[model samples]
Target: MEYPTIEQLHTKLINKEITVADLVAEYVDRAKASDLNAFREIFADTDIAAQVAVAEAMFQQGTATVLTGMPIALKDNILFGGHVVSGSSKMLEHYTASYDATVVAKMKEAGAVIIGRTNMDEFAMGSSTENSAYGPTKNPHDTSKVPGGSSGGSAAAVAAGLCVAAFGSDTGGSIRQPAAFTGIVGLLPTYGSVSRHGLMAMGSSLDVIGPMTHTVGDAKIFYDAFKGKDSYDGTSQEQSIAVSLKKKLAMPKFDKGGIDPEVLSNFEMIVEGLKKEGFTIDEIELPHFADALAVYYILMPAEVSSNLARLDGIRYGDRAESVSINDVYGDTRGALFGPETRRRILVGTYVLSHGYYDAYYNKAVALRATIRKELEQALETYDAILTPTTPTPAFGIGEKVNDPVSMYLSDLFTVPANIAHHPALSVPSGKSAAGLPVGVQFIGARFGEETLFALGKIVEDIR
Candidate 1:
């Protein structure tokens, strides 16, 4: 990696070779100069200086945590108290958070500077940041293409050197896909391993807040800081495990029908590299893989419909006046939400409706459980499972806006991990013929992030 790792920067801070104020100033300058549209705000006033001074004092007192003085970006969906958190939607565009999310509190307690919130798909419903109400975040490597949504802005921010690292919530493949598109490291930690207290809900069962950074080592530094239980979130857990790495990994038997040709070739290259490193590579059957995407679309929008209900124009966003309460609700939501958000809400409500409930929603839930069981059974025999993070590299902006089914196909490989409730990471493997980045993903058992990180370093070292 051209950029220094988090540990190296920490060493410099501890040795008095650099100061927090200086680091923040330089990063702030870089962020301002960026053309990627990565940030929603940059604390252009003295707020950044104020936060840096506190971190500077921690360094002076020799009481700094691993993240002390580090400048990091948070996805717009994450709530940082007293700041506007719109989730890139007009419904909450003018709303301000009342309190910080648990993860934000943890980062602040550790002395990390919260630079600003980055852009995302409105309500995190789209696969590309082009759906953002503000504007699409351009890929740093190639502006004509997307940086992947809904965490596109955060990934772009890190890749463009605007921040040392950034946090993005992955509902399906939001974080991992964007990281892959931008050629950075992205980790979707085990479900329940990190608190979702402050992250805006997309799919309650699927959302995860994770790191985007230049290298896997930097990702570890960020992950270790906030992966734990929080009373505010019912699903959060204090998952404890001893770190271990086996010299073997596994991949599913390929069903070449849906995968992009370049992605398959990249997967082959990764397999060859792992074999050269003396790690055994085996192909196992995951028959359920074929049905994963269909399963995800059903469950995700159902959750999306349920979670977004609280944002009534009366309580949360721009209001509409009418004598009838129904019109107030309809007009407000209809006008404020984007087309994709409305579509999902309608689909979600339809599936959860009376006659269709058992046919669609219930069946999907049952299949989801079976998928999780099959994955757990597979993990017993393999250290980790590998696949391409995204089926193709970043598509051009507006290319799939009118084609929702094709857009959803982008998450073909990633949705399975979220459905199975396992942890996964996207490591930049190689470049596509178009010179865009290609990502290979590793899915491990719950709380198996350590093994993924270890292998991710090997892949990073491949270059």
Candidate 2:
């Protein structure tokens, strides 16, 4: 059965058409019976009863919000007090969060019932959920294909109707890519617009938490509920800009060799459709744009190495017994950290090493600033930059697992937004000939979420 959207469900609850318990019970049963492997754990009714009661009271007191009683899921990397959040890694398999993530707290304040923590790539280090310590999350569209990662579990949960909405963190396209692969909407808010406190850090400068949903409107509702300045996150700040559309969208000219023919065809069709809707499509030249993936690889892994260093066995998670402290650290990480996590750590450490810092890391840093400036300059005239979210639709599971470079390329178009600290949204453009979903992304200027939302809705409606 297709589940009601957040707003639709809200109306039903307000009209007494259904109770919160009934809704939660239905989704819980479905989640339990599913074989998608989308969730790490579904909170027992006993664990959720208090929130249900709180939501029920909010309605009774006429203080309910759109999210009240909505059964939502959080990506495993997000912290929810009293729940185990392992970041889909064996290293933290038994680790419990002592406090809530800021976004989790916001959702609770809005009377949302967080249903469970979904699976992901171990330590948010892979492009496919196959890297998860538990298991890969299969795409809801086809059991044989991957849903995309490290937010694959959350993407699958929402796509499979296991929950009304799910929250996922994006560090180099984790959220958007999976959302595209699963035929849903994903938003990557401007970096630092959403608090990162309690989110297991992968790349601190590149990470932002956002919502995955079936509709653009739902994404906006979820974003509004949680985004703002945070005392817990020094990098967080509130967005106050009022964005009005300029009716102009910029499409970058780039090599099409790597992109699937069908995907490019679908995108061209979307561009033509928008032109018919009276929006101007400008082919703009952003020279540094083509270097996004290269820059992201260097900068993100560098941040990953630094942020993940704190996860030493002694401080937080599973530890290997050894006679020496060095052996303990070495053995624990080697045994518990997945291959993708280890690979990134090694690459990160290499680039940040004293002898190579100026050669690799510093050059990438300089190039990053150039790319950001190019994007900012383009957005000064264009409302948003548009592109297909991924080069192709969901590939078969394990297809790219052994080919790490191919997997990294999965984030091609989406990484530029993170590199530039701009907001980007992925909306289902249409389905491929094989019936897989193809997503179109809109990259807006910083604090231009409203512009992206407006553009995303148009893509959603046209589809």
Candidate 3:
């Protein structure tokens, strides 16, 4: 009854030790037990049964891929044609995607099975999953604590062993922060490395899709399956440069070892373990990192305001039945949006207003350029930058929910990578004194996924 990873499950299928139907049934049961409020919707048994049938046929024909019949959870924002794509908001609760996202399409081509949609922050705006319309997803480590967000459900599902792996979007650390809280590996690819075609826009330039799994190797496998150029996404670049750069970069040295007392000790232990394995550890500082959260809030909300402008109820979402068009637009948005969404929308509007555009929005854009330049310079000397994924582990479910600023600060460490357009990964380093998981982040230059995978492997091995 043990849950196997994607790789292990593939081997089991090949050896006939477990059938696809049996594997699917095991996950279904685990999901049912933990429930965890992780899934907003679990796929119907009939749908899973049909997928297992195809997997069984593929196995018999010796055509199964590594992901054949593998169950994967999805953050609700990513479209999966015919499935609801609510982005964890009440605004589009009944809306279904007419087509699959580029990442989803690739997952299907690799023969992965979509188990269900997981919960998240409304429109991917908050750091805690509490902003979800359904409810916050609880941390598997401690049910009273949050799992992190807006990709909290994806991380929680993986940590709770509900699925082999899950797909999560990262814009200001949605995926990495949650993975840290839940004791798993979360990968955020270099911006534009993965196609953003069907993902609901939060901050368009900052969002990137990545994988969350229990191990680094699984992260690599999933990233390989979906990364590369996609015609539908003009931003996706060819993988040739990324592949070549990965081969050239040296693995990072785990120096500058101090972290929080508990996190510091664990990080030191991991470094020593890696040193014995012959990997060099180096200490480097990224000064602009301190200003990342401020920069992120200013830039992300400005973009959110613009991207969400299309949702005025006149476009694709639910419309208010009102006598006037103005009332229809105003009432629908006011009714559907959560506090965080409204806050960002207001901030966005303020920054973009005629009198303030040059002072606020323009200033933030200039700071973004500086941050990006600083990160690029740092990567020239260090293969990757290392840090704690979060300032602390998962807190109480509603602990910081009402305090928007405090919630935004939770993403402080992870947001710098997004602002810099660099790839980052969060791997479980150890546990906090409270027994909650502690994660360490590895950030690399553009197209630096290979470095992340290499460093991630080294860290995970030591941990």
lDDT per residue (tens digit) for residues 1-463 in model 2: 3557889999999999999999988888888998999999999888878889999999999999999999999999999998999999999999999999999999999999998999999988887799999989999888999999989999999999999899999989999999999999999999999999999999888999999998999999999999999999999998756868789999998789999998899999999988988899999888888799998999888999898888778899889988698898889988998888999999999999999999889999999999999999999999999999999899998899998998999898999999999999999898888888889999999989988988998887776
Output the better candidate (2/3) by lDDT: 2
- Predicted candidate 1 versus true structure: per-residue lDDT over 1-463, tens digit per residue: 2677789888999988988888877788989998889998887548888889889899888889879999999899999998899999888989899899988999889999989999999988778898898989999889999999889999999988899999999988898999999999999999999999988999999999999999999998899998999888889888755667677788988668877899889889888988899889888888887577888999999999999998777777577776688898888889889989999999999999999999999999999988898889888877789888998888998899899999998988888889998999999999989899989999998989988898899898774
Give me the candidate number with maximum lDDT.
Answer: 2
Per-candidate local distance difference test: 0.89, 0.92, 0.84
Write one digit per residue (lDDT tens) for candidate 3, span 1-463.
2345678878888888988888888887888777589998898888778777877787888878898888888889999998788988888988989999999988877777788989899988887799998888989889999999999999899998998999999999999999999999999998988999999999998999999998898998888888888899998896523432222222222233323467667766766776687656665555667687898888899999999988888877688887798998899999999999999999989888999999888888888888899878877766677777887788798889888888887887798899989899999998888889988888887887887888788786678
Query: Alpha carbon lDDT of residue 8, candidate 3?
Result: 83
Better by lDDT, candidate 2 or 1:
2
Q: Alpha carbon lDDT of residue 420, candidate 1?
A: 91
Q: Against the true structure, what is each candidate's TM-score?
A: 0.98, 0.99, 0.94
After superposition of all CA atoms, the RMSD between model 2 and the true structure is 0.9
lDDT preference between candidates 1 and 3, better one: 1
Clashing pairs in 3: 253-280, 253-281, 254-281
RMSD of each: 1.2, 0.9, 2.9
Best by TM-score: 2
